[model samples]
Target: MKVLVLGSGAGGGCPQWNCNCAMCAAARNGSRLIRARTQSSIAVSPDGQRWVLLNASPDIGQQLRLQPALQPQHGLRDTPIKAVVLMDAQVDHATGLLSLREGPPIELYVTPCVFEDLTTGLPILSVLEHYCGVRWHMLPVAGEQRVAEFVIDGFETLRFRAIAIPGKAPPYSPHRHDPKVGDNIALEITDRRSGKRLCYAPGLAAVGPSEFEWMQGADCLLVDGTFWTDDEMITAGLGSKRAADMGHLPQCSSDGRPGMMDALDGTRAGRKLLIHINNSNPILDDDGPERAELAHRGIEVAHDGMEISL
Candidate 1:
């Protein structure tokens, strides 16, 4: 199984336009330690030829351009992307579906809640229906008897299940309701033939008992690292919302309490990486103490174009 990190930054990306925060400023200045990133997204392939995008970021076009494997080669419109699995309905994650309108019909996997949210709130499904044929499949939430199975061109056996994580609906949703099952989720993909597994949770709010149990012993675990500290945005004077308030639990809490890092420190995953990083997070500065701390703890901060083979 191969996983590709297409983009690693949060919503607006590392050097967000119109923001002059220190990290963004350093990135704008071309600081070698600071790397610019697009919004969070990844592509996974059971075999190199057939790929499935985890989330389609707003910068999907640029992301695809950076990866030659996904480029057309056989024919004028041939593409390696066979399907897209959405983790949520946020703009950064779902807007890129528009860019895929010109491609051949693609399958979209999402939970029923996410499907409804997109239909009523963003109307992405409705709009895409006009552009191209989209085969929709409902992703089975955690604990469901059935799992979503797919047959990639070159894979022997593969299946995926969605594990519900604690998170609320997107802030912009017309229906501002409390967190519910399917509002946010993590994906666990298992290659039955190879006995390798990967868990991806780029929008995790809190890691509960069930969530941790689901991630145990995975070959690769790519998790949320949206903020370094809970109050990162406020401390950076960028926004009033704390990391948790924005549906992401920080790596470390503001009061020095244990956070995601503390919780995931000794997990048995073969490799652990942080994704969906916010621009204000100090970890973006490669030389910063925060980055060193994460390294010491055996956690990697994912970057664009990173590839993992398991």
Candidate 2:
């Protein structure tokens, strides 16, 4: 399986537009030690010609503009991308639908809940039909499907399941009680010919038993590394929210403690990498102590344009 792990940055992207932190400063000044990235997404291809984009980020147009081979040859009505799988309804992950408005009718896959969110006010299909043609396919949260030569499975996520976090209300809540909606999900892409697997969970609140088996067995694992510590934002003066409050797993530190590194232990999985990095995390700089710690653990920090084969 030839997989392209696209932009690994968190929602706002590394080197956030308004921040002036050291990492952002270094990245802006052309220091290779510090990296810049786009939003999280991926692409997979069997013959290297046909490709399916995982999520259409707001930066899709620019991402494709940078990579000509992945450029769509057809207008809004015709595209090279066979389909698009949406992990959630977050603007960062789904707003890029506008870019594909002119391309060929896209085969979009998403959980029924996410589809409801997309169709809440204006059905995506109707909107797309107004702009261009689009094909919709609702995927079952815990089911699998065959699209083209690839087999994909969708796993419901704990973070996006809309089970209100302790002491907080669910986002996009309803009236009396918060509406339970699955906000996040994980995708496992398998090559029918080679039987290799690549598991991707971009926004993780916490690891759960149900998905543990797949993570342990995946040939390549891309898990969330949004915040180095639960209090990272607090320490950085970025915000008062905890990692879990933002719907991401705290992998580095928690409650003034320091065992967050345990989450990325190399021995837990054969091939593991961290993505969806937040701007406050110092690991973006290669020379940082955090980077060294991850290197020691045999965990690679995902970078933009990085490619891997399973």
Candidate 3:
């Protein structure tokens, strides 16, 4: 199994154009300790030639332009991206499908609830109809006894399953507060040939007993790290909502309760990395206490262009 970190930042990316936060300012000033990142997204391949993008982030164009592996190598219209698996219908995660409109219709695996958001509220699928059409594949949640397995064209050696994580829908959807069973999900991708597994959940909210059990004994676990504290955005003056209000679990909680870090502490996965970090998160600063804490616990912060093979 081969994994590539296309973009590692949360929505709007690091040093967001309109943001002037200290971290953003430092990133704009080209601080050596701070790295500017694109929106969150990742690609995985069982054979390196055929890749499956997890989330079509808004920065898809920029990310593709810099990654030679994702670019067309045959003539001018060929792409190695064979399929896309959407975690949710958030604009930051789904809008980038437009950037891929030039290619042939690719397979898209998404939950039924997320598909509803794309068809009604956001209507991204309706927009993609005029461009390169999408072959919709129903990605089943944990208990849909019917074939929940999604198979790609040339990547049949890899097994894909969706684990319904605890999360709500995007604000733009009608199901925002009334989320169904499949509004959001985590992917457990296993390379059957090598028995290597990867659990990916960049939009993680809460971790209960079932969620924690789902993460056990994986080769790599790439989960959410959107904020450092519950009131991160509020304290940083970046937004009016707490991390919890936005369907994200911060690394640290204000009420002295267990948080993201504590949840991950129990995971027996060989490699655990953090993804979808917000611009306001102080962990972006390499010399900050937040970064030190991650280092002390041996957890890595996902970065763009990072490649891993298992």
How do the predictions measure up, each by TM-score? 0.94, 0.83, 0.96
lDDT string for model 2 (167-224, tens) is 1122442211442334456777766566677777777676544555556776788888
lDDT (Cα, tens digit) per residue for candidate 3, span 208-290: 88788878888999999999999988888888999888989999856866898888888898998999999999989888888
Of 2 and 3, the candidate ahead on lDDT is 3
In TM-score terms, candidate 3 sits at 0.96
Q: Identify the superior model by TM-score, candidate 1 or candidate 3.
A: 3
Write down the TM-score for model 1. 0.94
Q: Which ten residues in a row have the lowest lDDT in candidate 2?
A: 156-165
Candidate 1 clashes: the total is 0
What's the CA RMSD of model 2 in angstroms? Answer: 5.6
Give per-residue lDDT, candidate 3, residue 178: 77
